[model samples]
Target chain A: MLLKIPLAWLQLARQKIRFIVALAGIAFVVILMFMQLGFQDALYESATQVHQKLKGDLFIISSQYKSLTSQQSFPRSRLYQVLGFEGVESVSPLYVQFSKFKNPQNGEKNPIYVLGIDPAFPAFDIPEVTQNLDVLKFPNRVLFDQASRPEFGPVVENFHHNEPVSVEIFPYNGTVGYQVNVGGLFTLGPSFGVDGNLIVNYATILRIFQDRTPEKIDIGLVTLQPGTDVKRMQAALTEILPNDVKVFTRRDYINFEKDYWSVRTPIGFVFSLMVFMGFVVGVVVVYQILYSNISNHLMEYATLKAMGFKNKYLLDVVFQQALLLAVLGYIPGLIISYGLYDVASNATQLPVIMSPNKLLAVLISATLMCFTSGFFSIGKLRSADPADIF
Target chain B: MNEKTIVHIKNLNHYFGGKSLRSQVLSDINLEIKAGEVIIMTGPSGSGKSTLLTLIGGLRSVQEGSLKVLGWELYGASDEKLVQVRRHIGFIFQSHNLLEFLTARQNVQMALELHNEPDRIAKVKAEEMLHAVKLGNRINYYPSDLSGGQKQRVAIARALVSQPKLVLADEPTAALDSKSGRDVVDLMQQLAKEQGCAILMVTHDNRILDVADRTIYMEDGRLFKEVVL
Candidate 1:
């Protein structure tokens, strides 16, 4: 009943400039938290985009495989072994390698991830990739990623205008180069580890990497019969497969890639540290605001104590101010962070976007951060002595 | 202690500082204030009159005596007990100590708010008390906009709004001019008498001596003289 006066809000609103400055400081920290968390989420999401797009219930990779960015090839004969298991519908070999792509316009070279698949089977669920399978079947012809970083060249632009886009490709450490034409465009974007992506037929990939033998492959896509137990099938294949290779359900494969980026990389650690720094900065800023506010009004508080109001009532006032700052500052911070996410997504061509979970996470952290500050500043309010007023 | 007595203090002793540096602020103080009584305490600075006033109002611990207000003992009392006693007594200070952000009526309403009265009733009582103090026209004005006399009047309205059993005032008119000081004391005496609550005020202004039914003096932490006006 005592607090129904909205005393906290009235006190804050009384000083317009100081109130705005406090909210702005808090909003700035909120933006910093959002960007760091956004980058971290984008790192995980972008890394697993290709894995999610591949059309298969189960996958096989070499035991030495660290991530998609790494080149780990297993014997193709091992992939053929999965067909012998019951309920197995079909299997296709996928070759992954990073090769040098020479921009057609400036001849600038950058490493591009190349996916080599047999055109006879639809290896990807992407509509653009599956519809352009015939183009990839032709030798030395590839489908370029429309979402790939623009540094790779204007392949998407030229291909859209029905103009010829031909570029040269070289093996990771090879001297000679092979020419390939961009026949179509798809939408698999770039990640932190890989700059651009290309899809080509299996034969063209072997020709580009002359040292690679037909018996070796990077990934084996295994489609199962409809309504079959994918978990049981995975267990059966994993038991029989040689120790040289490993089997994973599609979900586990995505997690494997995400784990490499989120848990095993220093970039992930840095993002987490930056977020914590934002929280510390937020606490200090809010503490200064609340502490100074308490200090400035020490006399009135002492008078209130003399009027029979308890410390509990005064503490409630300070904590209420903290929660108000948390919620009020969060609005502008979230709005501005969404704008920044668009800028970063466009500039980097990574999957940087806002999600409901991220929104809730930032809000909860902001509240906790402000509460921690309130907890620190109440020491001053509790010391206000009624006898001092006399 | 008589049933009509509002405050009873016997052998009250108070000290400041640690053992080696200890100095007595109040010594062997005995006093009694009855219902509807107006008692004024006059003393020089550092004579412990303010300290004694704070103890009677439960603003400070009783330290070494049997001190009772509204039938509640304050010696060795918990913080909670002090607060409960404080709620029954209204306090007015020299500086007017009004919250700068709150309007005059709201400042007066703060006293009644402690009783958990409904907002509608508190607002009415606060406005009526402000009118009684002749501040009806300035009910919506914040402390910054009011003059010194008006602010002190608002403090009096706040002190009497709760219908407290006793009122403690410390130099309530110290900051006002002659005319304003006279007006402030007149309003406080009139309101406290109408509410039937005893008044204990600590001040040095001799001009308002006739307003008190009895006047006492403190010298060197002891009650030195008394005069029944």
Candidate 2:
């Protein structure tokens, strides 16, 4: 029975134009579906990169903050109280602010999230952040993403000329202008949402927002010494922290960020709708192609039935053809998707990463899509009577 | 005839059209075909010979009587079991009914494949059957690539490949020229005699009736006469 599958596939290949067209249609749908999935993944990655890179046992934020990606503010002084709790090894205050940046040369403006942190944190606590610590610590300097350089308005031009650019920064509380120096560049993995970020040291941010009260900070990252139970420490912090503050495990923080983008944001809904549409279109195209093929060969099918070939055999042939079309189209579809992802990432300043798991998911979904289309036509095959051949 | 009946039809009647204007196609059809007998069924157009042949072949339901093929009753047999019976009996069509996708050799091999035979053996046997029908050189040719005579020969080869106990042919030579039609009828008669497989053919061609061991003439939905040629 399995040997016949290849034979059926060969027969499908013999019909060159129809097979190619059907395969291309399925591949087109699959590529569209993969892009949707990739976009969704990029959004999630963007929203959680900072939280994920911060290797803390627990995270302390304002209780009003539903997720790490949100703009809830806590008192900067709360970091001291968290450090005073039992089992607390160290607590770091982190500043997160969204600012509008203008390209000093092009004058093109874009929104960037400025993450301000101390350079003295343990390397293990913020592994990826430590890599850019030196560049970020330079006075009046900011580390912009290499991928986002174009949107940041000719930072390279300003750096080459050894000139400082007076850029205005709005810290929400007040707006201030500064002659900021461009430091080195850095890059991070593209998650589904949070992209286009700038990293700078605490002093530069403080100077830029000099008039803002230091009482309010965006969030706090807490690390426990070895042999400390992180869950217990989180519980203790939650009880001791003020009602306006919240504490979470590191894993919980990542989940919160993921849930925020996937559930709270429209990005997830839009992509999901697109994926569903792709699935429906794929099924419709494949089903029509197969149904038309069967109808064209109705006499042949009847003769086979008259020759005593069972209905099951007829179904096997239909399903084999569907699967063959799916696989044939999927190869090119995957290639096209990778190329599209690259082009879209460069054009939109979004990070789109394709992983083995994502590819596997796409392939499985494609196979299922083809199979379902084939299954939908089983009724027509079963109703095919051998007597019709007479 | 030693009274060893391969096909038994008793009081079989078939009708067409709705109840208000029903027309009988075959009424009180009592037939007993013995093994190795070449039975030629001859009739004019619309004489219901093809309908009778279909009934005997289990391709049509016996509405008012019993039809027994190889000792198994077919009148009320389950559809699945009837298919099992059909696998042991070969049917050849007027149009050759050869799958256009398959080559001449594959057309015959398909029948053997349906019977669950080993592929290598089925292929070899199909080649032998094609050779028997004098179509050995056209094994790789598709039906569309073959002439009318060659296509009919391939159909015969397919029907004979399974070594069925009975062979039913409907207008096996209808589309062929005179010489080709004679050749097909003669070959069918010869094979029937040599293989000892009972043959029932429904044909309108009267020129080849001389070769039939027995001939039955049908008209107006009933057996009109039996002629021993």
Candidate 3:
């Protein structure tokens, strides 16, 4: 049970500058992987914030919907049909589109995503959106997302400070721009695909999109009774609904968006490829360090072998050195990546978060990278013949 | 003296390449070493004294001969058995070969790690051996920080720290000055006597001949004569 002095650690520490350089290289690779993974996470997480936060157990979307960014509308009568199913609590119709907003003060134009919902039904968990339902029910009143990117003008600041705020909404034409008032502030954040957003009543949105009717809806939010099985309800709705519409639980709806971003989009592939490149670069750098260390001490290793040290013991020392490099390097990588995530979030307004699962994943990968490098370097040990030392 | 045989070699013919007699490095070698004794093999370059020394140390496989070290028949012996014998033997080389990264004490402690000694005891014994080799003040000094003579002393400490039953020195004093060389050989002799361990040295340095219990002359891969000093 007694512990031996770790010669591997001592050997690495002997060349302090070399050890520092090795750790620095590893840290750089870890940070690269963190940034790549962070971008990948943002692509999925930020794109599906609405789907994940909707105060409903199940949802219905147009089967023509390609992604959250690419949306289509189905008949609102289809949502009402779900009410006939057992265990159904309520159904809320939501309409979504992207339009340009003309700043009242400067006349600068900014593209913003718009969500319109029935004022009678609370479909989102956002308190600001629910509390000001009366304001959205009135014509030409919309709640601006405070967390939306700053280029959307001072609507949120003006709404909070009691200043005059007005925006001209363009439902595809400049002449048909409907001037509207900022009613309140909500907290839905922006994704890579879109920046800035506002929530309004379904009637208000109908007024802006003059060609669109109230019968067409984007998302059909369905609340279930307590302890109801969502899968059974989803199956019932799928059977009842026509092929033009699709029924999904909230989880599946979120996953749908995730799959779209991760599979159908090139952003996911680019980020994953960069992460893989970083792993390869890290392994090579660590391999060079361990290989050089072994080369320099070939004779010493042979001497140890002559002293009755098993090859396993010699290999253990090298592996221990690798683990030390991994752990020592990972600390700085994790610390620096956290700071980078914050910087990225502030600069881009995307939800670049450090999830526990991703952190665990990167840690395991970093260790494996170093361990594999250790394996590659031990080929030098085979040449450590004690007879050659003479 | 106990006079128990620690090394026995008979007709130990070894070839360097291709199993042919043309590549034979050592030819018809016959030798024996006893407990707590010093045996120095002196010969010219290419006379095969070093090869015979390596064979006796269980370092080379004995081809077409009978060879035994520490009761293990090393002629066609398994690497594991050779390794078991190596653990009981200490080796000193011409270059000292101290690990440049570790301090003198750490280098010596590395030897005990093979034997699975606890860290605390390894450190204590390593320090004790360094002090015995007159390197007490240099225990914390890295090999790069030590003088050539001091590095060799550290090597000696590493070799003797485990109380190995046999010490093999191959031109150990070749890299030192005359004064340092004499001092190194004197230290090896004193430690081998104090520890009651056998010493097998392959050297061409005639100045240190007085320290050996017996000097054997090898010529053309064969023992030519023996001289008691």
All candidates: TM-score: 0.96, 0.89, 0.95
DockQ of 2: 0.41
True contacts kept of each: 0.77, 0.25, 0.77
Better of 2 and 3 by DockQ: 3
**What CAPRI-style quality would you assign to candidate 3?**
medium
Runs of candidate 2 with Cα error greater than 4 angstroms are A1-7, A66-70, A77-81, A122-139, A156-176, A189-195, A239-243, B1-3, B13-26, B43-51, B60-64, B219-221
Tell me the tens digit of each residue's lDDT in model 3 across A215-255.
Answer: 99888899999999989888988988899999898888888
Per-candidate DockQ vs. reference: 0.74, 0.41, 0.64
RMSD of each: 1.8, 3.3, 2.2
Expressed as tens digits, the lDDT of each residue in A1-390 for candidate 2 is: 324213466456657788888888999999998999988877777667677677578887887887654677878888898888778788877777766676676765566677777767632344445666776656777766655536567665665576664555555444445556566556653334344666777666777776545577877888789899988888888887788887888788888878877788887788889998999999998998888777767766776777667777888889988888788889999999999999877776666878998899899889989899999977788667766455
Best by DockQ: 1
Range of the 10 consecutive residues with the lowest summed lDDT in candidate 1 chain A: A1-10
Model 1 C-alpha lDDT per residue in residues B1-229, reported as the tens digit of each score: 9899999999999999999999998999998899989999998899998899899889988789899899999999998999999999989999999999889988998888799899999999999999999999999999999999999999988989999989999998899998999999998899888989999999889899899999999999999888997
Worst 10 residues of 1 chain B by lDDT: B105-114
What local lDDT does model 1 show for residue B164?
A: 95
Query: Candidate 2's error at A39, in angstroms?
Result: 2.3
